[model samples]
Target chain A: MTPRVRVPETGYNFAYLDEATKRMIRRALLKAVAIPGYQVPFAAREMPMPYGWGTGGVQVTAAILGRNDVLKVIDQGSDDTTNAVSIRAFFARTAGVAVTTRTRDATVIQTRHRIPEAPLAEGQVLVYQVPIPEPLRFLEPRETETRQLHALAEYGPMHVKLYEDIARHGHIATTYAYPVEVAGRYVMDPSPTPKFDNPKMDDCPALQLFGAGREKRIYAVPPYTRVRSLDFEDHPFRVQHFDRPCALCGAGDVYLDEVLTDDAGGRMFVCSDTDHCEARREAGHRGEGA
Target chain B: MALARGFADPVHDAQGAFRAMLDALARPGLVQALPAALAPPAPLTSELAAIALALADADAPVWLDGPLAEAPEVEEFLRFHTGARLVADPAEAAFALVADPEACPDFSAFAQGSPAYPDRSTTLVLAVRHLAAGEGLAFEGPGIRGRVRLGVAPLPAGFAARWSANHALFPRGIDLLLAAPGRVAGLPRTARLLEA
Candidate 1:
């Protein structure tokens, strides 16, 4: 059997970053909380792990972890996914913190793709792993230009790009990880979550943190923050999703990950967050758990 | 090769070089050489090599410009020792390394900090000739207690003007580091050059 745990015996923590690194990340986290939605550049250390693999989220979690905080990790909104399992196990060994799949119970939920269906409370912190932190990076090839645009609050080019896409494709082809304006100051990427989850961000009671390790940025949107998606009056915003309800939970409102069930294009929909689904199941709600 | 006692490899030097980089920025023009030992080919200073070894890692994504290929030994050493991703375009790099700032890439093409989170900027590490107490412009900002001066080359054509645009973004903009044989200096986005 492949050993699920892989932390070394000594020298560095299970992740290999030293206490100083965690302290630096901690300092950045404090600043992130203080500024609210401002992305803080940190001297990100290289983990034994690869990039795009929760390095940023791990750094944030490692920095803020104390003796009491409960930690949870999810990928594609499921805690049992291979990547989620790996990261959760990492924190368990290094920080020795309790790990739970239940969203309601976790103090720190390090996630990729989707946020929990259960409401995040004020005391809780949600950390997201970001592949690319910049929304304007694609539109403006130069960081120098994008900075100027953001400084000037000039998002004309972004609106143009989205409008052009709609004109050509009849719909904005963006499936997940759509961008949004945060707390009226920064245009932020809500990780890769489908737009179905975008509405959940407004005035949220819980603090949301975004980390892009490869990009070396740590930004946050505090609890009860304001977020708006950039859209023209002629082309209003619409969330993306399949027309079907969750096949397992039978819930019509949840964000559904289209699951292929048969060869003839027959498929099933399920709650992306497994913990919430499991909780619902125990509470006498079951769609068709396969 | 004698394996580094604690770290996986000696080239994992970025682990230590980061603190020095931090100090250089936190202190402003305060010169301190790198700790790791490295050798570079002609036109590349050992100081510059150390900075690269200290900053670049396997997971660093792209944005390679300047004399990396010009010095084949340095290139091979980096690839062999550090599994760093080679980004062909300067526009793509997380850390942009230059042996000589005189021929550095345009600062505009790199990642500047975004408005809401001006810290998402890219860091440019250039290998320069000597670092002295005189030269360049005076500086003051978040970290410095008062004003300080340092010696260095003038910005390339369109450099300072574009940088002014970057600076205007405040919390966003590129951070620069100038390294010599054993010393380094930082120019964080929060810092500004006071014209004499």
Candidate 2:
């Protein structure tokens, strides 16, 4: 008698995406990597979740996730947030893959709004959930016009927008979703990550993949690629700095979030990255709250 | 000729190959190993066949070069496994398979996608006798950190000149995947060959 094959309880294909869909996404991913920062259009498939809830990142992770890969998902730098926990559970249930909150242990990380605080190695892949893949979308609005601009290497409008911000506020007021030039060829939006995380992207060892599901676009920044934030010679691009260290772990030089203690007008700033803060605390780091 | 087999476990195997291919392309000049289970016909290396199986599909039309085009069994194997359409014109192909890199056409002969959509161009998978790291051509570009050397034996004549022309077409040119016996290396259009 032949041996019986045990099927998954969910009855869904591995990673919840069919083989053909995975193939199509893989092809688009190759093209996206080939032409760094150039948005490649793909046939976006609807997922069980909503669009704003990182459908694009989920698809990219599903297509690239192998049986041995250790997956990690984060939203706004926190691993235990509702979005992050849901995504982690989704992959664990469907693909039956290992999930970790530690950045170093993860082989594939699906992120929204922020890159991890820890440095990524060469073998790791970073998938960003991008809401807008085009830097010129808000400026040009017309797809045809933006395509022409990108083809001609016309980035004057982007600079003008920054210049306008400088004219009004005496400095560039734009913070998140800063525009960057990839490999000195195409101007791209590095998702909604804050300008504070922009420097981390330059010469990053990990391969960075960006996906925008509603827009049906995918782009990439290959490992060690040049990603320069837009700035003028006199007024250079700068990252946000904190006046004090994290109240929870006493960590410095990391993005922080403000937390209100009570109605007694007391507030404390803590590390936005939960894993980083916890690791630091375990290593004997202490703060006022700790 | 007996029909060959594809991946033993199609889903996981293809995923593994795709990750390797992704790493190979993302880090240009780096050699990545493909799954060793595919038994393709002659003139098609296991690495190349693995890439085709992982990427090519009914929507992706493939163009086979002289050596591969002449082999009827190769076509049957690819069709049976990947179901990719075979096209004669290089410009119409989404992916091109080349067994003889020495006689392969210039990069201009293939589809250099328009400025609007550069990703629409063809990706060439060339089967070479040797792919390794030595005192070969140095590459510098997006994926490369400073510089890296890659030695691909039996490359086409005037390869530097041809690559220069191809690289000149920023965001609009053909990418290359050089497959040796068990490993493959990528040469995206962005990677520039530093003259010796």
Candidate 3:
């Protein structure tokens, strides 16, 4: 195990970004929390990293980060992924805060494309990196019209899109970045998280924040807020199903990733949440692969 | 009057206060404790002072009501600490400090924001006598799991009716932070105040 890093007295401001920037982001965050699911426009600062690489999530995390917070970063549910490791190390050097891989130990989790499998408690915060904050941007393609649609609660077009999917694909084919109605008011884009994670957001105890760097938008779903996925009466919303348990952890009803082993197409389905799998393995849960 | 000291450690302390405020707002009806060391002027509790120090800045204008507005020390303390622009009109404020909740302005008096941008509305930081857990008013909405009971003393008159109207605005309405001596509770526009 690595030694815990201490917060340095010199170098950058507490969290790398200056106090003014943090204040700006903090004000925006307050507004975001006030109106759940409503996209609040903010002045996105240019971080050290490039766009499309979790800058928005980094900003949000930096704004809320404190010396005592146990920070965790995950990319596609894996703590060792390049994105996650870089962010974790970035904060470690910049803020000098303690970093953890355990889901339960973390007070703030900055995630890209997945929520941790463990249930978050009341005080924990989940920040998501959003590439596109607007759920209707691709459909309407007009910022003015989309804002108007959100104002009027005009989500019929979203249902129609789902209906069209059912007509062609025999099911609602929105696999990722699935749209959800927050508090029955605003139609929000829940980042690129798989539809399987949608249900986990409803009535969740943890505060959920979404930030889109390139889009310059920030939104939130407060703890215990009702987050309902868009669906039809005949074609109800459903998550992707797996026929087998995780090859490594023997965990069922969890999102899995398929890894090819042999040249002739031999593959094994494993849990996408790496920490969850490793924890289960440590707890003596064995599977065929183990 | 001498200017009171702000957060001992500006960055970390503000971060802690912001987290407390965030948690309070995220979990409506749940009381979160603020940094207690802050000693602002009378009528301005430490919780509200910490919130103003953490969230209110030059970009965000603040409005005070009743005793808070009358007390020059309170205004000076806020301006000296947070550097927030104090405004006269409540509608123009991004944050409103209500020292006297009983005589505070109605929800409609503050900025309700427009249909296009509801987040632009004002957030009220009301100083209440106390916050307790009891068979008080029932609240159900976002941030609330099923239902939660909150007891706020000396609320504005016709609070239920005013809250109902504020809630009816849906995406456009004011949010509130009830500040007690050491704790604060949030009442976002999404939370509905059930009548007795």
Candidate 4:
């Protein structure tokens, strides 16, 4: 006899959102996929948490997640962080779905500020919590001007802004949330993730979705899509690097976060990806502490 | 009218169908198998019905063509399960269900959305005789790795030309979902049909 599965007794609906709202989001998501990197307006729903606390990612995850889906939540690349734990627990209680910290095992991963160190597969989806969906917001304060710019394919102003960066600083000064051109068309902001993860957005096997709750917008980059980071021939786009390996897992290639152990100048660099670090440690990889 | 048979478990079944549709859309020209549920009247395949159930709601107006539009069973099923309102005009439809690809209306008849809000365009769900890979139009776009081929049978004479015209619209054209028997494939406006 097969073992019976336990049913969730949570009062909330499946995934904690109504089917109507899910259908609405799913419709927007389909449009987002169709137009690759073009932001689609959605009926942004209010969540228990505030706007900046990943309400957008939560809504997107709720719409796409199934009962069998393995969910993974991350904040600043760590699964153990407060935001990650809170969102993961919210889904676990409402959806009664299995949650995994392993990037390889997760079918749906909701992230804020980082992509996983491990490469995502074809079937997996990465939901990004975007605070601002528009790359031109800072340049043009008015939505009317930006919409006209996109319609006319007038991206000269964007290039001018980047050129100004070179004029002011010796190199392109912008470090995180680098803008990218998608499918040779729309220019998209890949959330606030450090520029290190921008390359991972290009021609990736997994689908990437961005949702902004406050902005009431949703966008997507389908699998195998061309995403080129904005740069000039003289000053090419580059990622941040570290002179030393991770202090916890000894990962040299992955993105690292500098952690100050004490008030003194005693600081250690560690892998920002908690799952990657834990996996490395389990595999007998040790760092300065060990 | 007989009570139309719907998914036994609404949440799980709809989620399953939605995921398949999502995969199909994300990876254009890839044929994804859908659940064979609710065998509707003439012209409407099980795959199309499943998609309609998953994506359609009362908020979305649907446009239907061919014999399937006249079939009461199809109407009843959509009304009961999806609560989608049927519209006579294709342009006004949020989703258009085409029974026969050969007799389907011109691509321009449906909503291509606006310059400001391109996502408001209509999604055309065309019921094809077969959705497979082999000799047909080659596809290269966002979802495609190098190139993927999709062979859609019984298409109208001017489909390729119309598709090119539609694609030229860019960021503003109807997205397509092709269904055959138990499998479905996507052809978003971004997908370009290369010369065979």
Among the numbered candidates, top DockQ falls to: 2
For residues A205-234, could you state the per-residue lDDT of candidate 4 as single tens digits?
999999999998999999999999999999
Enumerate residue pairs that collide in model 4: none
Compare candidates 2 and 3 on TM-score and give the better one: 2
Tens-digit per-residue lDDT, A1-290, candidate 1: 12323333454553446655654564465345434455677878786579989888888777655545678899998888888988887777765667788888888899998889999985687889988877888888887787677667787887788888799998676767777887566677788788888888777767677888888988777565567876768677787656776777777778877788789998777988888877777887767654
As for TM-score, the candidate ahead, 2 or 4, is: 2
Q: Candidate 3: lDDT of A145?
A: 96
Candidate 4 — what's its lDDT? 0.89
DockQ rank, highest first? 2, 4, 3, 1
Model 2 lDDT, residue A52, Cα: 88
Full candidate order by TM-score, most accurate first = 2, 4, 3, 1
Candidate 3 ranges beyond 4 A from true positions: A262-264
Of the candidates shown, which would achieve the greatest lDDT relative to the real structure? 2
Shift in Å, residue B161, candidate 4: 1.1
Measured on C-alpha atoms, candidate 1 has an lDDT of 0.68
True contacts kept of 3: 0.84
TM-score of chain B of each: 0.82, 0.96, 0.96, 0.95
TM-score leader: 2
CAPRI tier of model 1: incorrect
